[model samples]
Target: MMKTTKRSDRIDLRIDPKAKETIQAAALLRHKTISEFILENAMGAANEILAERRHFHLDAKQWEAFQAALDAPPRPLPRLERLMQEPGMFDGPEQEA
Candidate 1:
């Protein structure tokens, strides 16, 4: 069973007439209102985009390589260490307003 939630938020779009017509035709083909079609497709696209950030899959060989890299000893970065030891621009005494 699917649970329904009250939709209290609204989104407005200013689309070109041709775009609107195309969307309307597609929505009709799917037997959904324009709002339903747009929301469903947009949500699907949003999930795909966010999934890249939230989850990753690796094959056995790739997983082994990744684990090896993580297990490797830390490398020395003299320049980076020197840069970190130096005072940054914001580290100086604050100037009066």
Candidate 2:
């Protein structure tokens, strides 16, 4: 089923006079209203930021190596084991309340 979403919010901002002129000229050049141009560009930028990690394109050879790494068995790290064994501040003797 398709979902219908409403854009019922407003975002108002004040830009420098020169900045506003620049954006307005760009929008006119693109044959779009200021709102449309701003929304399209902003949405494109937002998607790039948010979806950066959500999509990955890998060739077959890279995919094979990635799969092999994930398939490898767990291995213990000696340094990590030694660190865990060492005493920490939390390991101090507890005092009665």
Backbone collision count in every prediction?
Answer: 0, 0
Q: Which ten residues in a row have the lowest lDDT in candidate 2?
A: 86-95
Worst 10 residues of 1 by lDDT: 86-95
TM-score of 1: 0.69
RMSD of each: 4.8, 4.9
1-97 in candidate 1: lDDT tens per residue? 9999999999999999999999999999999999999999999999999999999999999999999999999899999999998888879775799
Candidate 2: the clashing residue pairs are none
What would the TM-scores of all predictions be? 0.69, 0.59
What shift in Å separates residue 23 of candidate 2 from its native position after superposition? Answer: 0.6
Compute the lDDT of residue 21 as modeled in candidate 2: 93
lDDT of 2 by residue, 1-97 (tens): 9996898999998999999899999999999998889999999999998898798988999999999999999798999999998889878875799
Assess candidate 1 and give its lDDT: 0.98
